[model samples]
Target: MMTTALSPEHSGDETPKVKDYSPTSYITHSNFEFCGYSLKIARTLSASLGVSAYVWEAGIALCRYFEKEKISFAGKKVIELGSGTGIVGILAALLGGNVTITDKPTILEQIKNNVSTNIPPACRHRLKVRPLTWGQDHTNFPTDYDFILGSDIVYSLVSQPSLIETLRHLSNQGATIYLSSEFRTGNGSLPFHEVLLPDYFNCQVVDRLMGKDITVYKMTKISTDPADGL
Candidate 1:
């Protein structure tokens, strides 16, 4: 729809470290196959107000949702946590279900455009894009969601705890939380996620391959968290 776009593969993040709000471009791939129907969706960044967002690798990740349709999504109110490109969780919504997308304040607008571009005109009403900073007040988040998701978000020591905290705060009484991440060494390269999450939610590891060495961990959160015994 828009001419602005990013690369399918990031050679390097040229995004400047600016504190002001503006539009930026994000690019990700979305490949969908239905019987003989194959479609590739490309997402571009659209910034307005102060939010910056883009659609990500929805086509590839959508395969995961198809594989794990039972747990990934189905008749659920879904919220995507730390949506870098917002592709992974947005596809879940496009498939059918209520979807809310969240990201840092800096990326708010990008999340909006990505979500908007992917949905049909009618289904556009079903999606919600909001600003969500980890460990911060989530004023508009519903009390419960059938599923919560995060993708490629745990890349720093500064963000892990806040992400988990946001996960816990938004998760409802028996909700399942799914976090997809690639392992990268950062200051948070300690026993961080291993220890903190168990305190509030039971974590289930769903392993998946991300290209090669990069692993996308499909972490599930249980309602009955038994941390004392662990």
Candidate 2:
């Protein structure tokens, strides 16, 4: 799978290129094959919408890892955060997970469209789209998920703390979390890995796509009480 980026600043049919990445302005849709099903994702481009309308490399990489490892989401209760195009969460549903796909309220419609396009009528009941703005709307969800998924969500340092907080809130002791991120200089990803996340969860790098500079992490919550150590 090829990686794509969005340059939301430019407009009017002229595609602005970002380094080795292609801007999503000219690309209205993307296609992918996962779990033996072909997925056609519709994309919208606007200076205001930014990254939420496009599928990032990290999201695709995570989907590839799932198929490669034959990861089982069968019968699992799953939720995906920052579900931009809803690709990752949609795949989880296809793998038999009862899934909730979420992003900011503005992006929820796009995700809902993708879910409807890809998931068949029979499996439609297995997935739902909801609005989730990290730390703010986490209470609306229950802490009983079997797995939590995210991709390319840790772009801003300002949002990392809240994202970590939401992750902690949504996961129970038995829940597992999976996050995939692209490596970029000066991005919040480093601090998230080194500082914020370690305080709340035990994380391990379960997969790496070295060529793409993306890594997928598996995390489980750490006990909050000091007494647990004793």
Instruction: Give the best candidate by lDDT.
Output: 2
lDDT of 1 at 59: 24
What candidate 2 gets wrong by more than 4 Å, as runs, is 1-27, 225-230
Overall lDDT per candidate, in order of appearance: 0.56, 0.82
Residue-level lDDT of model 1, residues 1-230, one tens digit each, is 11122333421133323334345643544444422223334434344422223333332443354444444354678887767556655677766768888776776655565565666789877788787777776655776788777655565777777766677678766676665544546635234545766677666555554453223343445646467348
Q: How well does model 2 score by local distance difference test? A: 0.82
Worst 10 residues of 1 by lDDT: 1-10
Question: Which 10-residue window in model 2 sums to the lowest lDDT?
Answer: 5-14
- Shift of residue 4 alpha carbon in model 1, Å: 23
lDDT of model number 1? 0.56
Model 1 bad stretches (over 4 Å): 1-72, 187-190, 210-230
Task: Provide TM-scores for the models.
Answer: 0.68, 0.86
